[model samples]
Target: MKTAGGSDAAKRRAGERAAEDVADGFVVGLGTGSTTAYAIRALGRAVDDGLEIRGVPTSFQSRQLALEVGIELTDLDAVDGLDLAIDGADQVVDDADAAAHGALIKGGGAAHAREKLVDAAADRFVVVADPSKLTTRLERSVPVAVLPDAHTVVADRIRDLGGEPTLRDAGEKDGPVVTDNGNLVLDCAFGSIDDPDELATRLSAIPGVVEHGLFVGMADATYVGTDDGVETRHY
Candidate 1:
């Protein structure tokens, strides 16, 4: 039996297309999530093809996945500037066709902060995702990373902001799901996030809050994959 890793093969092919866009010998920033799994696999193929590139994964899961795929990995301290970052976006949209201008909600893997660190260090941040994620406005479904000791206090603070916060879990494990950064994650549902930038900034400012998963102005361009094919929207 030939299983397609529980994801569509065409989606994986779309990741190949994006990987082809990457030049050899550049420091790449790897992202986390299911969609990014394909990208990492594709990038690994590139490495096998004799590209002398080094990868810096955004999360421990991403790092492990990259190693399994044959991509040479590196640490942040070893590299000063990242040439490119190929990762997945939760959502995307175009603002008047003046390149792509849509905010994104990420961090489902609880590695949002590390993703941001790599994205910020990169020269170009390329976001990849399915077409269904495109939206005119950013909705905050981002899992907020916090300390377990302050989960209740943080949830209350979020509730005061009209957000019903729920502690993210790994299916009744008798405890909270811990992030790669060794913090607890809160899967927050704040309805339609009217202002993602402001909300992200505010949430990040809160104490005990390690990082929020919303990525604003962090993408240079986005590649949206559809059932038919893929398309690029530069921002």
Candidate 2:
């Protein structure tokens, strides 16, 4: 059985290996999550060692982490585009041989909207994670960012699509969990996503849905860390 500590170590190794893809003079999109935190730290060390690069963080948490690590930071508005983006996925849907043809479920941290924007702007989006995150099918409840006023309607729409939607409650607060963009989250449980592309399309067609956790065909490559070592797959 895999322990949490061992998985975390793998996450760190995956992050570090992904950070090696960063180069001098590149404008990078820093991702949000524990696994990506390792990448941020590794990038910081590279910066200190004379690698000239700038980072656009995906969330406040990532921004603060980057600042503490001495990484030079920039806003998305300040850059025309990103050379690379490194992120972590809550669930990855791809085989070892599959490169770019895959999907992902993210937003465990409520920053999916911002993450999608940064990732889409990047020339290459690299996913870093422990091998434990990979799955033959993405069955995690998909996170949908909805307008506060549209939650009920969106929930109904999700139900129409055969999904059970629940408003995500804040663990530390007394209300629904709000995203960084001041919206609400609906965790739509569909059991197993059979057609990710079609599901993503249907979710996007919802009026109040700002964004969905389904990252369909967005990853350029992924680095998965296992007990033996890190493995890289391109798509």
Candidate 3:
């Protein structure tokens, strides 16, 4: 049986290729995840070669990685806008209406809220992932960041919305896993979402919901790594 090495190699290739898009003097929005970690390394190498670019990292993990690679960093507010954002998604589905566009579900690392904010601030958002991430529709569970005080209330609301919500627990510790923003995550399963936009709207309307992983019509392009090579899709 084939293990995940192929997939991991694919992610590294996709990340390196995505990093090639970063140009000198550009302010890049660094995203989180294993795939984006490769991008960070590539970007760091470019920085060593004197690529005068600055990075705005979306997560603490990303920030540390960028620093280790010697990528110059700055705050999001310090920059007018990001030239590009290279990130990864848990799932990518083609838009039902427009085949060119993709609807993404992210936050597998529980950093979707910050990822969305940074991605939205960029002039171009690029998602890099292995081909395994592509799907006909988003069937994976959606991750919703909720205020700690409203975790139970939000889970109840999600249940009423036809989802099975589970409060994400920490792997090492006993209590729940808290986010950088001091929020908790609810992994809500709604099966294969036929209409993600509609569901996203409904989830957003719920009080105490900070942000969800349903990224509707946000991807400018996606770089998918396959057994053959990297495939590029533009939206």
Error of 2 at 27 (Å): 0.4
Q: Please give the TM-score that candidate 1 achieves against the real structure.
A: 0.90
Give RMSD to native, each candidate: 2.9, 2.0, 1.9
Lowest-sum lDDT 10-residue window in model 2: 93-102
Candidate 3, residues 93-207, lDDT tens digits: the string is 8544644258999998899999999999999999998878888788999999999999899999999999999999999999888988899999999997988999999999999
Model 2 earns a TM-score of: 0.95
Please report how far candidate 1 places residue 73 from its true position, in Å: 0.8
Score each candidate by Cα lDDT.
0.78, 0.91, 0.90
With a 3 Å backbone cut-off (N, CA, C), the pairs that clash in candidate 2 are 99-234, 99-235, 100-235
Candidate 3 all-Cα RMSD: 1.9
For every model shown, what is its TM-score relative to the native structure? 0.90, 0.95, 0.95
Q: Model 2 segments beyond 4 Å from truth?
A: 1-6, 96-101
lDDT of 2 by residue, 1-235 (tens): 4555347779888999999999889999999998999999999999889999999999999999999999989999999999999999999877655432558999989999999999999999999988778887889999999999999999999999999999999999899998888999999999988888899999999999999999999998889888778988777
Better of 1 and 3 by TM-score: 3
Candidate with more favorable, higher lDDT: 1 or 2: 2
Q: Cα miss at 173, model 3 (Å)?
A: 0.9
Q: Which stretches of candidate 3 lie over 4 Å from their true place?
A: 1-6, 94-101
What's model 1's overall lDDT?
Answer: 0.78
Per-residue alpha-carbon lDDT of candidate 1 for residues 140-232, written as tens digits (9 for 90 to 100): 566888887888888888887778888887775787888887899988888777777778787887778888878888888777766667777
